[model samples]
Each structure stands twice: as C-alpha cells, then as structure tokens.
Target: MLRGFYGAGAGMITQQRHSEMLNNNLANAQTPGYKGDNASIRSFPEMLMQAENVGAAPGGRNELIGSMNTGTYMQERTPNFAQGDTRQTENNTDMAIVQGDVPVNEEGNSGALFFNVANEDGDLRYTRNGSFAVDGEGFLTTAQGNYVLDDAGDEIFVNNEEFTVDAGGNVFDDDGEELATIDISFAAAPEDLVKEGDGLLAVPEDEDALPTAIGDDDINYDINQGFVEESNVDLMRTMSDMMESMRIFEANQTVLQAYDQSMERAVNDVGRLQ
Candidate 1:
C-alpha cells in the first residue's frame, strides 16, 4: 500500500515535467529558430512479489506471486533539430539557411548551415537567425549586437555600403567588391549541438567534436538575404500535445489522490478495526 502511494506520486511528478516541457514548446512556437524538446519517461525495475508463508505449501519452495512496479521518472528531454519555414523580409540584413535539397521558394538553395557569432564574453555560438546589422565600429553583428564571424573565425568589419550576400554566403559591397564570406558552419550531427537561449547553439567542448566550416563544393545552401528562419514547432501538433499532457496530468493527479485516500483509510479505518 505504501508502495502504491510512492508509485502514484512518481507518476504525478513525471506528468508535471511533461506538462512543463509542452508548455515551453507552446511558448516558443513563434520564436525564430526555436527547437522543441521531447520528454521521455523511464520506469524503475519491477520487483518480484513472492507469496509470504507459502513455502510449506509449495514443496518447501517459495511460491511465485507476481511482479510489482516501483515507480517512473522523467528520463530525458531531447531537442529536435528539424528545419523550420523561411520568411522573406526583403530587408537585406536578414538571412536564412535552408537544409536538404529542397529549395526554400524558388530563390533558395539547401544545405545544413548556421551563422557563427560570439557572445559578450567572446564565447562562440552558432545560430540560424541571420537578422544582422552593422554596429558603431562597422562590424557585422546579430540583433543582440554579438559580432558575426567570418570564414577565418574573426569578426567581420565592413564599410557602410549597400551590401549583398550571395548564395554561397559571400558578402559584397555596392561596388561589387567582395568583403568577406560569412562564417557558415555545420555539425555532422546537428542534434549534438547544445541549445543556448535566444536561438543560439553552443558547440560541445569535447575535443573530438568541433563544427566544420562550409567550404566550396561542400553541401551548398543559399544564404537568403532578407529572410529569417521561423521556428519549426508545429502549432497544431503542440496544441494537441498540450491537451493530451493536461489530460494525463489530471489522470495522474486522480491516481495520486486515490492512493492518498487509500493510505488514509488504511491508517484510520483499518487501524481502528485492529
């Protein structure tokens, strides 16, 4: 009976975590370059339930009764790295990187690529959000003012001129002079990248794992100038998931309450009978 209470409580806790993850996904559905996380639940090992005092009736052997489950826990929250839709802003400063061979509209090519940026502390990060601007020092920077990196892993500085980014991520001035190629990079397994907030991803510190630069003849993707990648979250699916999680949470709560009541009755009513 006590084990039942613990099991039900564990279930409630797992459902609560699931609900939180679903809510977070819903909240980020409209965020650009946002990825959704999937929650996984794992159950503790089951215990063998043996019949007590049944040894004398079963050839002096302990009688097998059944198995009882212990409890469950939230195992992991894995991020999904699926591509999102691209929106054309025609603003020249915005950009989007498309994946796979499918072109985004009729103007975009496809490959796995992301722009490199540095935080205020100069810690490197990667992002698909290309909404960039030139700062006071004429350095290309993200919306948060983080300097955008170039192919050489250095901050890109350009004069205030009408600039254009080509399909290969090369930047050019109004006079058609090439300035710098935007630092486009890729991880063999993008899912391995750790998610930092604000649509940025930090490369793992593992010495064996490092992001590679996008080289010529490599998988080509259009750096769609004047465009931004939207969040990949499916709104309808997320709404359905939220509703289902709520139902599961309620069910778990009911189970937990029932377990509590059973425990109460066992303590009060059964104790009084004894």
Candidate 2:
C-alpha cells in the first residue's frame, strides 16, 4: 500500500508538468514561429515488496510482486522541436526566412542575433519573426525603427520613397530599377549564432563571420516584399496528446485507490481479529 502511494505521487508530478506544456502550446497557437515543448518520464528500478514480518528468516520461495510493478521519474526537458507550418501574410512589413539553416559567427551558442518578430525596429533585434516594414526615411526598417541590413553588410538605404522587392529578394526603386538587396549571409560561419527570444539570432563581436568578410557579389538571399511566415503548431496533434495524458492519469489514480483500500482492510480487520 505504501509503495503504491509513492508511485502515485511521482505519477501525479509528471502529469502536472505534462499538462503545463500542453497549456503553453495552446496559449501560443496564434503566435508566429512558436515552438512546442514536450514532457517525458523515467522509471524506478524494480524491487521485492517488503515482508510483513521484518527480520523473519526466509522459509519459502518469495512471491515476486516486486517484478510486476514499476515506479517512474520525470525525465529531462526535451523540446518537441518540430517546424511550425509556414503562413503567408501579404503585408509589406511581413517576411520569412525559407532557408532552414541560420548562420552566425564563431560564438557557438551565445553569439546568435535575435530578430524582432514584428520588426518593430529595423535595427538588429533577435527574433524568428521575419515580418518587417519600412521607415519614414524610405529605408527598410522594422516597426521599431531599426534599419534592415542589406547584402553589402550595410543598412539598406531607401533614399527614394518608392521601394519594391523583386523575385531575387532585391529592393527596387520607383522606376522598377534595382536599388539594393537584403544580404543576410555570413563569411566565416553561421553555426556560431545562438537562439535569442522572438525567433531572432545573435553573434559576438569576436566572431569572424562579419558582413565585411563576405563580398558584395556573395550577397544572395531572397527577400519577399509582402509576405509573412505563419506559426507551425498542429492543433489536432495537441488535442490528441491532451486526451492521452488524461486517461493515463486517471488509470494511475484508480490503481492507487485500490491499493489503499486493500491495505486499510488488512490492517483494520485482520489485525483486530488477531
């Protein structure tokens, strides 16, 4: 009975964490570039049930109850780590990086740059959100007034009020002429970038993969004028997971209750009779 109590307690704790991750995903269903988190469990080693009479000498073959039951522990935090679906929002400020690989400088993890999902400022902010807009100066800017960098490793200056992005992700002027390109490539490496909040990436100054390292001709990233990438969380899958977790929790609870009653009867009635 006592063993069952301990098992159930552990099981409850695991269930709580599972529910928490599920709730978080549901809350971010509408969030762009949102990633889901998942929970896992570990098991306790099997052992024989404690004998009723402590220190009693072994007389008969031990009935193996220990081999039948299992105790568990909550495992490490493993993210669901699946790519969200791509959504298309035809807003001039919206953008998405179709390329799966993000490059950074020599800083393995910390050097990553973060981008503003909403592109509040064209200036470099960390975010996975590719949505962006232009500033009053006609310069490619985020909502926050930060300048968007071009392929030349310089700020994409829009001296002309009219700007357009072509098939090759190049920005063109009013006469349908090519003005500049949004160059987001690296010279040394992209592996050094780390993931900051809002789906942006960042790198350190010491990192060699600076804009100067890459040549002008090397700038080859395509930028869409009026499109945005949508969030990728699958609703059906999340609901299914919720149901499964509920059933498992209920089953564990029933087992715990039965074990309690069995022990209660054995102690209250059997002990009294003796």
Best by lDDT: 1
For every model shown, what is its TM-score relative to the native structure?
Answer: 0.88, 0.61
Which sections of candidate 1 miss by over 4 Å?
55-60, 101-112, 216-218, 270-274
Candidate 1 lDDT tens digits, 1-274: 7787788788878878888888988888877777788888899999998865555465565668898998889998877767889998898878888765422323242324678899888988888777788888888988889999988888987776669989878999888898999877766566667887887888678645245556645455677888888888888887887788778778877887888887788789877898
CA displacement after TM-score superposition, residue 156 of candidate 2 (Å)? 6.0
Ten consecutive residues with minimal summed lDDT in candidate 2?
A: 109-118
Candidate 2 lDDT, 90-174, residue by residue in tens: 6655665453334333544212112222234433434445566666676666544556766554667777465667645577778
Pairs that collide in candidate 1 are none
